[model samples]
Target: MEFIILVASSFTKLLDPVVLAYVIAGFIIGTIFSAIPGLTATLALALLLPLTYSLDVTIALMACASIYMAGMCGGSITATTINIPGAPSSMMTALDGYPLQKQGKGALALGHAAIGSMAGGAIGAMLLIGLAPFIAEASLLVQTTGKFSLLAFAMVVIVIAQRGKVIKAAMAACIGLMLATIGLDAMEPVTRFTFGFSSLTAGIDLMPVIIGTFAISEILMQAGAAKEDRKMTEAMSAVKIRRRDFIPPLSSIREIGLACYIKSSLIGYSVGTLPGAGGSMGSFLAYVETVRTSPNPESYGKGNPKGIAASESANNAVCGGALVPMLTFGIPGDPITAIMLGVLVINGIQPGPQLMAGQADLIAPVLASLLFSAVVLIPLTLFLLGPYFIKIVSIRKDILYGSIALLAVVGSYVATYSTFQMMMALVLGVLAYYMRKNDFPVVTMLLGFILGPNLEEFLRRSLALSNGNPMTFFTSLDSLFFVILTLVFVYFLAIKKPLQKPTGAAQSA
Candidate 1:
């Protein structure tokens, strides 16, 4: 009954004209940003973070949540209309979506994508609401050792998931940890990496790193590619799309079946709860599993609507799922949520078990905004602006890249009002460009940077409490469980899976 009243009150607060306008505007902006290749939702949020300083906390959070939801769905627009995926999470969608477009069934592909996104977003939101409180309660049992172990597990999982590039991923992650150490030492008050500058003592800000890594580096890469690439107009001509083409037939939805949507959403949500496992992994895993289990597996890569449905649903579902750890445990599952954590902190709200127990007013409204965004996505994408979205891909590359570069520069400076931050952004951008070109998994580096301080702090605190005993981690059952869990994950992701290929080859020979 209390939960019901809280939700009702949140809806009432969100219905204000100003708040609704922000949400709508955010959704539109996010759609445009994510529909363009090289512009991701993370970049959108990072750019918008400075603007939130002047707005009310509730209003700012509402806009962020709405944008997050819209961005996750907008990638499918380009993936289906063109061969390019707007976001990494939509790579799976491109495999089947482009084929459908070639077959002149682009509208059918889009319809399935939109429906799957809506269902997944809604289900993921429900799971977050149901699971957050319980998870918070359970988190109280974990001591410092267990928390340290959990973070170690998350880092190892992230690196191992890099597939054949675990070594490169580890190297990149180590670089991030090194960068994170530039600030004050987590345990002692003494500065370690100041390098004689007073400003360095304050440490590197996350805003500069995030902006530089994602936005500025992307601009550099695009600029380099533009030299050899043909004009957008010459490469691909735009197709004429009508309103009637946006609707999916009833028969098509029935063929996809309710079970697939539910299962995919569940997988997305579960993966989202794991730190560092983002929407890209969720969509990829869900799409692969759906293909493996489908009776018509042969049709998966050749314009199958089920492939589009599975990919879209899982990626969109990740939005709500990623929030669970961020809100309840103060651990961000991915880069976007890491930015959202900054939003909450800037507004004077600290995340943790205490947050869930005491800040229902703030948290409830954000949850309401998520559900409202999913409901609004259907009309906004399908009925109101379906045809116009197809034309988004026709935008000029030079103009887009130029505008983003300008935004990245101004946004980074505005975040700190310091020339040093702008320089930091440029340096990181160059480094990130090289890292990306080398396929070193920059996201893993980011994950390491974000979690490094926390891991170090927890480890130090645990050791201090145990009088420097090395076996202290095994003394507690919670810590022991996490330690074992980390080993198991490492074995499967790093060792057992890699060895399987050789064994199979030997048997075949």
Candidate 2:
């Protein structure tokens, strides 16, 4: 009750009109960034990170939360209209959404997406707000040895989750860990891999790494795309969305049922809690479940709205689920939250078990903004802005990519006013471009970089406590739990083959 009161009190302080404006603007920006192909909310947050320095911490956090929520919702726009998923999370949405668009019900599909996003995001935010405090308390039981195992679990699970490309994922993660070891050593006063540059003492700043990896690499990727790939399809010119088309019919909602929305939301939220298991996974699992249970499964690819419901609801729900470990355990579930974590760190707040109780004032507004964005702004933005989406997504690539390149370089420089960092952004961007071109997963690498320092610190501390006895890890109950958990994940991810059940549109896929 006291914790609830503390959180509620935090909201009152954020009731300022200016703060609300920032949240609204941030959502709009996130939607725009995510609606365009090859862009994401992660990129929007990366661009805004430098600005967080000037903005109040509460306002910055609120903006980030809203942006993250909007990112999930915005991707459905392009998926329905252009048959292109603006964000990776919307891939499942495209399977049904594009077919609906071809049937001239594109606007209706988007409306279903809006409804699903609202329900999922609202439920997810509620879960996050209600459960984080308790989870934080439970997390305190794990000490140094357990912490090491947990991080190792995150790394191994993320790597194996790549399915067919596990080897590539592992290699990428190793590169990240190696990069993390470039700066001053964690325990000793010596550096490990500076390679003789004086400025390398502090190592690479996260802003440069993120900008180079996502923003700059995207620019490079887009630049090299075949001309035919960038052209608008004939179907995009055929459909026109109006204000009235944004309201979903009652019969269609009944067809999907409240149960479908609720179940999909739960799936997304659950998947979001796992490391490297992102929105795409949440939506994919939800969509798979929907197809498996539906009475007329074959109608899915032809133009069924239920698929849209499963995809949007599950992906949007991921917003709340991804935050659980980030706020309580300081571990990022995905790149968007990773950037949001940077926002918290940049504001001089350290995340962990004590963060919620100690910094309720700072955390509460972010949660409130997330819930508000999901429940209110999602439908509102879709309705007000739906008419113009087709036009907005049709902007020329040259202008769009050019502007992004300028922002990427400027953001890197603005972080510390160092030209070296700006140059480093390009260097790292080129490296990431080739890595992506070769099908390597950069996200695991980024996670590796983020988790490497802590993993090393905790491992060393645990070994010291046990007088260098490796058996102490297995002997400790908390550590043993994580070790066993990792093994289970390995069994499921690498060793165990899934039972293939084909139905509906998935039959062809």
Candidate 3:
């Protein structure tokens, strides 16, 4: 009874007209960013950070949070309309989404992605309401030892969770980690890999690196091929969502929905909370986990709605999940969060333990923004934006790819107007292309780059706290459990699984 009242009261606060308008504006901006290739949520937020400096924290957080949430969903527009994925996290969506679009089910695919995102966002917000206090309480107890162990566990899982050649994944991860080491040492002012280039002192901005690696590289690889028309041939029946198709059967929804929601939410939250692991990791990990556990795992690469649900929902959930740590600890979970950090600091709201305690009103509006933004996005995406999505497919592939390539270079240079940034983009693009040819998962490499700094920082901090004693890394119960879990995961992924590889039909059976 008390919980219900509290929730109802919170709901009432979100109904403010001014708050609702800002939330809607944020969604529109975010969706626009998602529609453009190479324009990521992180970059979008960073660009807006300075503008938010004079605004109140509530408005600032709302603007940033809304963009982060909608950006994850907006990627599906390009993923479905064209073969290109607007976000790396939407790559799997491209596999089936584009195929469905080619079959003239573009509206259906868009509908599914949008609806799945809404469901995921709603559930994630619910979880936030229920679990924030609990998670925050637990996070407060995480000392340096526990933080390092948890980070280590995340790295181990990232490598082991990758499908295909584990060695290649490990190699990619190492490369990313090395790239992360290019910046100055966290504890010391000494540079590690800058090579005396003044521009390299801050290391490479993660936004440009990722944009170049994924978006630019993708375009360059495909630019040689002539554009083929992928426009939908059959006319969409109607904009209506059929009652039968509106929701899965109760039993099916109960079974698959629970699996999708829980797995996606947990994976989404875990990855989102981790310093470097972002929406891409969250969605990819959820999709992978879904495949690993599904009875019809073979259906994943196809247009399986379950796979779409898992990926879409997980990525969307990451929006709110990411905010928990950022708001509470002042530590950005991923690239977008780092940008959000900039926004918060610009707004004169220093995020940390005192944020929630001292500024509950500001926090409430941000939370309100998450719930309301989705509500606004759904109608806008379904009705006003539906035709625009279809229109994107009409653009020639040559033009699309060319523009993306140019943007990748421009965005890279804008991050730091240095020739080295462009060179790094080209080099990484070539490496990524070769790596892709060999079936090495580039996403894992991205993850390693993202997590590398945090892992190093945490490890060093843990060691320093214990006077250089390695045992300090496992002083807490959470740290101990994660260490054991890491070892067990490694054994299965690296060793035991290889021993079970199929020699013939015998293994298949």
lDDT of each: 0.80, 0.86, 0.66
TM-score of each prediction: 0.92, 0.96, 0.67
Residue runs of model 1 more than 4 Å from their true location after superposition: 1-5, 227-236, 498-509
The numbered model that scores best in TM-score is 2
**By lDDT, who's the top model here?**
2
Candidate 2 per-residue lDDT over residues 16-119, each given as its tens digit: 88988899999998998888877888888887888888899889989999999999989999888887788888878888888888877889999999999999
Q: Write the per-residue lDDT of candidate 3 for residues 244-362, one digit (tens) a residue.
A: 33333456445456667667867876677654456777777777777778898766555666666787788888877877766665555665766666556545576655666566556
Extract clashing residue pairs from model 3.
Answer: none
Error of 2 at 460 (Å): 0.7
**Candidate with better lDDT, 2 vs 3:** 2
Q: Give model 3's TM-score versus the native structure.
A: 0.67
The digit string of per-residue lDDT tens for model 1 on 1-509 reads 46535755788876699998898888887887887777887878877876787889888888888888888888887787776778877778877887898889887788788888888888888788777777777877777888887778778887887888989989988988889889678667899788898888878887788888888888888877755335445434655567787778889889999999999999888888877778878887788788879888878778888988898889888988999978877777787887777788767787765777788778878878888888766555666787877566567777877777888898888866998999999999999999999998888888788778888888899999999996988887888998898888788767784522222112211
Would you list the clashing residue pairs of candidate 1?
none
- Residue 158 miss distance in model 1 (angstroms): 2.0
